[model samples]
Target: MSAGDDGLVPDLGRGALTDRVRATVLGRRTPRAWFLALGLATLVSLLFLLGVVYVLSVGVGAFGLNIPVAWGFPIINTIWWIGIAHAGTLISAVLWLTRQDWRASISRSAEAMAMFAIVLAGSYPLLHLGRPWLAYYLLPYPNLMDLWPQWRSPLVWDFFAIASYLLFTASFLYLSLLPDLASLRDGARRRFQQLFYGVLALGWRNSARHWARYEQAHRVLAVIAAPIVVSVTGTISLDLAVSIVPGFHFTIFPPYFVAGALYSGFATVAIIAIILRGLFGFRDLITRAHLNRLGIMMLCFVLVVDYAYLQEIFTAFYTGEAFYRGVYFDRWTGPYAPYYWGMILCNVVLAQGLWFRRLRESVPGLLSLAVIADIGMWLERFQIVITSTHKDYMPSAWDTVRPTAWDWLTYAGSIGVFFVLLLLFIRLMPSVSMHDMRALLHRRREGGHG
Candidate 1:
């Protein structure tokens, strides 16, 4: 209560603020365990190379496609991966805008995943081109003959969506990274590391003026990123919505894609969080409170998506459209009925159980459920892509397109490659947002003592 205590408060604040909190590139002790982890990840990446070789040598038919279903797994997998990336920007950008303190610990990794997964997803389009080379024809250029993209096409819309979203996410990630880069620049024992971090720090001296600008730039980027992410998913839906296919065409496609995006994105977040928490032993920072909050988000999206599902059926039956009803019935009662029902059970019913406290509180339990939800969401995208492609207004055009062993191999390998990248990131980089996290800890301590 005295003036003396007030003066000492600033001293205490500065003392509690440690450099260890901000820098995550490496700690005091480097371990043998880290290298072993990297070696294992390198092996997983090689498996992905095998899939790449198979796809390249055998052709697109290796994955199995007949006529109308020419697009197949490529488009669906692209959207699914991109959708799974949405939560990164959502957590970092939108939560930052709302001043959510929880973001301090989670945002860095979330943004990292967003950038990496987006890059991963972007590769599929080139693979789908089959030639893989000369795929740049899709891009617009000023030539003597007047070369330009077909702006009227949804595929064109997808190109723009992925490109813009990736750029925006990169900017957002780098902007957040500047302060941390400065910490590394200051702490470096090596000249090359110093030079690398120094340039990125942009001569940041951490003055009060610089701090103000840092906060402002982060907020402005978040404001822009939130809508860009939503639009990206919406454009994916447009690819299906613009189609005349009975199963694929619907007014609900945009919202449906967005919901599916959130669902899978959160699952991706959950699995990543579980691994990071265990590997880094960051139990205090990324606590059960965060898990519960994420669970709630996952549940909300599933319900919204389930509602969309109901409406799709209602519109079909309610309008008495013969083709719509027949397709709807065929989708549910058809050979793929197992997949449809499984999606409902895993995405909807299983996610709803997160309402129970014990389930959210359990680590292994929650991760298992998160994996289930991710699988269910993938099935949702697959159902949308394949079923609709095969069947449409014209019944004669319809034929089942079965996935070959190569199709299954590529899907599984993509997931392995994703984890391999994530494990390396956790080891090489700071897994938590040290600056933001310290800011939060200081605030909490101040509030508690007062």
Candidate 2:
């Protein structure tokens, strides 16, 4: 973990570190690159807003939902987003608990990604609900009507899981921002700037007692967040695992889902880190060392996911369950065969390149792998969700799951939502956690890893 010749963060003192972080937010003029990116994101977001309006006006008929394949792109997008969100908590909370100093460089962006992705994921539940206005009925508050939510349902589980995760992620992001906000307020050049960040800082005096409380709270939150990351995905998998459908009924789902989640989540974090490193000039902060570590993590999860794939196939063959066996065969040989093989190539075959130190450290190599893995993860979700439901136990009821224009539009637009939120986050505040980076610098000065 030593910095060696390639440190994760630039060896800067307190003043330089503060200036480096503060300049990202408080710069008098916006960069042309930022303006262009924001314009594109805003345009896509506007289209997304239009798509939502269309969906609301036209109803669920706008999507492609047939008899056997009721769930379409919405479910796929929901699960994909959820998987992406999982990496944030794992990187932020789990790494902090394990004392990985490299995390300090990327945790803020990762956590912000998770929080934004959660909102995107959460929207699917409402959007997919035919009567979206009646979504409040999912909540189990006392009412005059005797009707209540079915506690045993997976949908209900999803509601609580997503809700709980949102609360935890929001609190974690806000609490961690307090110290930075206080610094920004103190260094404000204008009265408006001081007032703006001052209110957001929540009046932190940074006393010894306050620092002690912050540390205690952060530790507890990290502990709480670790389980939430594991449990939320497990609960989401229950939606499929509990089903009696052939591919859906497998016992390997929970672990597989979690592995898949981390797999794609790490890829997404890498994508964001790499893009922002260039766009925001964080080459020193988000260094190649950090990218290499991320690549290694992605490779580790690739092995886990590959093992789970083998297990799913092996279990089917061992159990001699014709339904499960057929599902596995159909996955690689059926109409979705291309997707399955593409997933294998992208996730398993191509990902093996990371075993080499050179490739892991290469910018284009890491970026290519990250993008390919993200596509593969989406395909993984598509195969798992669609293949299972499109052809169930009854052969007569089998049908193809095709997405309409609206389905494609809405899904693409959700990506817009993620970018818009992320771009705004980077623009408005110190995207990098200044306090944590300072700590990292301190650690390195003390002859430790950062």
Candidate 3:
């Protein structure tokens, strides 16, 4: 079947398609559901802020950290958020480079998701620092005292990785938005609206020169973004792998983490795509085909994750090292055994549902699987961070570390922060890319699949 036959972009005039997207931001009336969701998200974000204040005031002791298990929700959530962020780059940059038409409808939101998820991911390291104000110590700058950041510290590596990715994502997102922002600038009636978009549009004139330069710049950024996507997660994985902890010290971690990150990321994109379609009524633009493609992507990466899981176990046993074998045994029968099995069930077993074409194309089925995949990925991080550290070499030092109320609050609040930002973003800006959709329509008219 041809791409148009699958309804990537429904048969609509350029003006009609543009109007449908513009109306989401420029419409006279707003959706009640958006307001409700925003209000709830804002409340939770406030709670997240409150949690931050509590942590700053009371110290990182507010989290569930102990002797061996110094890493807690902050580290787990950081890795989880970073993994979630990967899909945005993959969808927006990698797929764009590969000339995937389906990415047009979703890339804008995916980029936005990447932007926010990285911010949240970057915030955790600061929160984990006992004295977050001293975070600048990680930055390599000449100071009066001539103090330099430890060059070998993984924490230093994380700072640079997150910072670099954040800059790249922001640039990538804004660059892609130039054409769409120009559209909003032209379509907006109010002076304030025009000025707001005009500044962001960066003087885009829709001229041939502007289009050529924009495409060149965007393609360059996409090329940079492809490697950034892999390296960011790989660096984060190194933060664990560099450690001698039995669960963390694996040569397979870099690729395993990369696959897991993309798996969670695509799952998040699926969730966001479903939410966007339902909230903004983009059912025709974002069709069952989009969901099916997302399902396929999720399945492909998750199978890699399932293989990595087995490889980890095999490596643990093959080494003939008591520590490595004991770690897996503990994972199976220790206090955190349930979490280990839960991750297995969600990621390895339940994820197999995507093999069925019926399930891949079912809205409810895809959404459920996506949510489960995210949960499983989170559980995977949870086990890697906590279970790995909780049981160290010294039997006397081995103790269970449970998340305190503050940990739950902070984790849930971070989620709230992400949704609140996303909700506000959709309300203010075009959630779908008007220009990209227009191009898709143009391709359909020319009887060529883009």
Candidate 4:
């Protein structure tokens, strides 16, 4: 193998690679760790369900919302989850289109992460709707009374953005899965397993014609997904950017949010890669080099985020607008100042560690940084949502909005929901892209790296 190929994959035959990945799903004995993790995730998901029921029975008033700070955990979580979803598309679609061989092993898991994250993202808006049952009102379906959605409302925009992104993500994931599902169907000894995979495979036979069509479809989707990736987050950012709110009305928000989203997204992919590697003993497939690449990407985006932070502050003072200047002042010295500083610490200070090669390649280092990056991104969203509106233009209306227990409960529960869905996804499907890995191996062999 060439030196450049080091830490991509281990020396293994095609059959060995296929067997290792397939065994994660098809093996008879479930791992004890998997059981434990699933149990914990399920418990948390139940908690989330309980929170949802309580909110529905009572109201969104169960949260820490006030007249000024009407947007609370719901909006914060929606933006955070949506941001996390970006990495999956970036990894699976952008990397594939670019022919980055390192993406082969991690792309499937990344896509799954994106899929679940977007689902969680989309759910928050419905929860935030005091009457979730009325969520359909956000849609533009014709009615007998001739009522229609307010096209100008951010809620309607979110509805379309999230729904479109979710559909695109699902199609991308299912399209990518067809070949692997066919492999699972062919390899399954049990009739039930065969039937399950066969139905999902959509009758994929791995013929040359099938491959040709698959390539064409996948490339087309990839081309479409790249723009969707930027547009979705930018649209979400416009929810704040289009507003008259001092801190929220920055022109830089679209690009700022995009960078922050990709930053957090790559960090999440890294965390998932590390967990998958540790749990499945995929040291050879998801190697240190992959972590290094992830860290580099994270570093790249966080740098952009840091620059945005500076630009935001500069734009505030440059305009010489008291409201904008006060927003920056409040962010630095207000009640939520701690969160703003913590975001700076995590996204700016600690993120600089990625510039060091040793730290980026170290499992513990990369994992710690990834977790920190996600937390930092959350803090960024938290401060942006809460601090912006908590003390608006009017001193008379300025009030503090502290999160109620229900707020924490709902937020934590959402995290649980995401994990539960992701765990089940990995257990049922191939965590790694089998066909992509095979193609990688084939290319490596042709290049004398096998």
Which residue pairs in candidate 2 have backbone atoms (N, alpha carbon, C) closer than 3 angstroms, thus clashing?
none
Off by more than 4 A, model 3: 1-3, 447-450
List, residue by residue over 409-441, the lDDT tens digit for candidate 2.
888788888998998998888888998988777
Model 2 TM-score on a 0 to 1 scale: 0.97
The residue pairs in collision within model 3 are none
Q: Lowest-scoring 10 consecutive residues by lDDT in candidate 4?
A: 1-10
Model 3: worst 10 consecutive residues (lDDT sum): 1-10
Error of 1 at 434 (Å): 1.7
Error of 2 at 245 (Å): 0.5
Steric clash pairs (candidate 4) = none
lDDT of each: 0.77, 0.88, 0.91, 0.91
- Give lDDT: candidate 2, residue 284: 84
Better of 1 and 2 by lDDT: 2
Count of backbone collisions in candidate 3 = 0
When 1 and 3 are scored with TM-score, the better candidate is 3
Residue-pair clashes per prediction, in order, are: 0, 0, 0, 0
Considering TM-score, which of the candidate structures 1 and 4 is the better prediction for this target? 4
RMSD of 4: 1.6
